[model samples]
Target: MFTAVFNSFESGMIYAIMALGVYLTFRILDFPDLTVEGSFVTGASVAAIMIVNGYSPIIATLAALGAGFLAGILTGLLHTKGKVNPLLSGILVMIALYSINLRIMGTSNIPLLSQKTLLTNIQDAWAKTGIDDVLNGLLTAIGLGDSLPKTWSILLMMLVITVLIQVGMSVFLKTEIGLAIRATGDNEAMVKSFSAHTGNMKVLGLAISNALVAFSGALIAQYNGFSDIGMGIGMIVIGLASVIIGEAIFGAKTIVRATLAVIGGSLIYHFVVTLALRVDFLQTGDVKLITALIVIGALLLPLITEGRKVKARKKKRLMELQFDHKSLEEGK
Candidate 1:
């Protein structure tokens, strides 16, 4: 059970990156950028190709970000410059990126199992000299074995990345440019009235959003030891599910809390999915169904709450009307 939970958390760390990107586009920019599916595979393909060509893992990851940024720029241009609908613009770019991803990989998939991943190489070097064992012994001596596991290297790296991004996003959103970008989402006309170029803000916001997503995809490919073209299917839904779940379970009342919720939500989503798989009664083979159900539940939760509120309001109004009728009858 512990191993399974740990595995889900590992998967969640990778997805937390994507969830943050989704938060940028959907929450900050208020743009439904469906380009996520293509952008994700594009990042994975670029990273896999670069790794195969002997590039440094970090540099390769940056390259993936660039590729995703370019895709986002194309979508932005279509919507802003060409005056195309934002949804259609994203769809067009997403479609184009599918072919681009194929070209990047030169095939449908690229496996990195035999290659040296950033984390694996670090672990290998640490294990070679028994440094990890020594560290574990020290940790155990301090009575911290359960709190801090022996396999802490990768977790440490992922935690640093997540924290840095959460802090960076909080700070960035406070900047003038970031404020303008956020305003474009809140009220494009009002921002335009203030001489702010809402179009440019949308472009910049989307570019940044996809860049983070691509970076996440690159890291995921390395961690998973493979880049599969089909891996990105239903990604947008999963992202939405994570966002909704995070917001539902851990109300997004603050920036820091919201970002943490996204990461936590990703882990929760993975844990729940794994749990469903373990269930003996469901008899479900299609994992996609799980994704669909998660998305449906997330999408409906707010509506359900709203419905209850409306019903309560109606009930209260009827009671008031009944009291007024009773008072009128008493007067008669």
Candidate 2:
């Protein structure tokens, strides 16, 4: 059980990066970019093929990020410069990437079990540098050493990496360019009135968003030991689920809080899914159904509470009116 939870935590950290990317487009930029599914596969494909060709894992991962960035730029240009509908533009790019990713990979899947990945090398370094010993000692003291096994190294590394990305996102979104992107999402017409090039902002925002997503994909492909063409399917829905769950549980009133919320949401989603799959009757194929139910609950919970509040307020007002009428009759 502890191992299951730890694995979920590690997986959640990686997915949190993708969630942050979705939050940028969905919540920050107000762009319904379907390029996520394709860009995700693009990242995995590019990274896997490069790694298989003996390229450095870091280089392969960065290349994937660049590829995803270009994908976003295409979607943005198609929508802003080519006079295409935003949704249609994303669909076109997404469809195009289906072929592009296949061409890059030269096959439907690429296994990285024999290839060296950033995480694998980093794990080796942890052992060489005695970091593993120190962490093992700490874990043993906490009685989790049995269930956790060698996962401490990975958990620690992912924690630092995810926190760094979260901090970096918080910093970036507060910059001048980031503000422009936020304003564009909030009111495109108002931003245009201020003489800002909203087109450029959208392109830049999407480029960054997909870059983060691809980065996550590259990591996931490495961690899971294989990158499959079908792995990216339904990724957009998962990302949206993370954002919705996070924002609902931890109000996104500020940049830091919002990013933190995204991370928390990702963790919660993974944990829930992990536990649900352990049920005797539940099958692995039920993940999408679970995600759908989670999204529905997150979206409706606020509305349900607001409706109850309205009813209570109405009742209170009626009671006060009745008391006032009784006092008037008594005075008469």
Candidate 3:
């Protein structure tokens, strides 16, 4: 159970990065960018290919980030220059990326089981620096000696990355251009009235969004030791789930709080999925269905709660009216 939970946490943190990217386009820019599905695979494909070709893992990951940025740029151009609808522009880029990813990888899958990935290198350094021994001792002192997770080093690394990205995002959103992006989402006409190029803001917002998403993909490919072409299937839904779940649980009243909530939501989502898969009758293939149900539940929770509140108010009002009528009748 401990190992399972730990694994879930790691996966959650990685996917949280992608969720942050999704938040930018969906929540901030109000852009229905389906390019995420394709950009994610593009990141994995680029990183996997570069790693297989004996490039440094760091270089491969950076290359993947660049590739993802380009994919976002294409989608942006299609929407802004080609006069395509935002939704259709994303769809077109997504379709094109499927072929582009295939060409980059030269196959449908690439395995890095024996290759040196970023996580593997981190593990090696951890062992060399005696950090594992220190961690083991700390766990023993805490009566968790037997529960010491083997993935602790990797988990720590991911935690650091997640925190850095969150901080970066919080800071970025407060910048002048970031304010423009938010304004563009809230009211494009108002932003245009202020002399801001709404089109440029949309394109830049998407570029940043997809870049973060691809970065997540690169990390996931390395962490899992493989990158499959279909790995990005249903990614947009997952991202939305994370964002909605975070906002619902954390209350997005502020940017910093919202970003933290998104990360927390991702962790909760992974934990729920992990526990569900532990059921005896559940199969691995049911993950997508489970995700869909989770999203539905998250999306409907607020409405359900609000409905109950409304009913309670109405009941109270009715009782008060009845009491007033009784008082009038008694007086008469």
Candidate 4:
């Protein structure tokens, strides 16, 4: 059970990167970018093919990020320049990426079991440096040696990466261009009035958003030891769920708080999914359905709470009015 929970947390941390990208578009840019599903696969497909072709894993991952950036640019162009509806532009790019990803992989799936991935290399270095022993010693001294996980090194690496990305995003969002992007999302006309090119902001924001998402895809492909054509299916829903869950729990008044909430929400989301899968009637095939239901529930939770608050306020006002009427009658 400990291992299972730990694994879920690790997965959540990885997916949190993608969720952050989604938040950029969905929340910051107010762009309904459906290109995520395709951009994600583009990242995995590019990374897998490059790695299989004897390229360095880092190089392959960077290439995936580049590909995702280009995909986002195309979508942005379609929406901004070609005058296509934003939603339709995303759909078109997503459809086109399906073929593009297949061409990159030259097949529907690519296995990476024997390949050296970033995670494996880091894990190897950790073992060689004897860090595990030192960590074990610390845990033993604390009387928790038995609780130390075998994949602690990988977990640490992932945590560090996630934290770095979060910090980078927080810093970037405070920059001039970043503020412009946020402003563009909030009020395009106001940004335009300030002489900022909303179109360029949209393009830049989408590019950065898809780049992070693709990076997550590259990491996931390597972690899972394979990349499948269908791996990106329903990614948008998962990303939205993570963003909404985080905001709902952590409150998104500040950028830093919002990013932290995204990471926390991802952990909770994955843990819930893992727990649900343990049920007797749920099979692997039901995973998508479970994800959909989880997203629906998360999306509705805020509305449900708001509705109850409204009712309570109304009831209180009614009681206050009744008290005032009684006071008037008594005074008369």
Expressed as tens digits, the lDDT of each residue in 5-93 for candidate 4 is 87898889999999999999999999989999999999999999999999999999999999999999999988889989989999999
TM-score per candidate, in order?
A: 0.85, 0.90, 0.91, 0.89
Error of 1 at 315 (Å): 14
RMSD from true fold, candidate 1: 5.0
The TM-score that candidate 1 achieves is: 0.85
Ranking 1 against 4 by TM-score, winner: 4
Q: Give the better candidate number (2 or 4) by TM-score.
A: 2
Candidate 1 local accuracy as lDDT? 0.85
lDDT of 3 at 282: 98
Off by over 4 Å in 1: 125-150, 281-285, 300-332
**What lDDT would each prediction earn against the true structure?**
0.85, 0.90, 0.91, 0.91
What TM-score would you give candidate 2 relative to the actual structure?
A: 0.90
Candidate 3 lDDT, 1-332, residue by residue in tens: 76788899999999999999999899989999999999999999999999999999999998888888888888988998888999999999999999999999999999989999988988988877788788779878988777777747888888899889999989998999989989999999999999999888988989989998999999999999999999999999989999999987787999999999889889989999999999989999999999999998989887888799899999999999999999999999
Please provide, for model 1 over 1-332, each residue's C-alpha lDDT reduced to its tens digit, 9 standing for 90 to 100.
55566677877888888888888888888999999999999999999999998998878989999988988888888999999988888889888888989999999999999998776876676567766678778877887666555465666678778778878987888799989988899899999999999999999989988888888898889988999998888888788888888887777887778888888878789888888877776645656788788767876787888799899999999999999999999999
Off by over 4 Å in 3: 137-147, 307-332
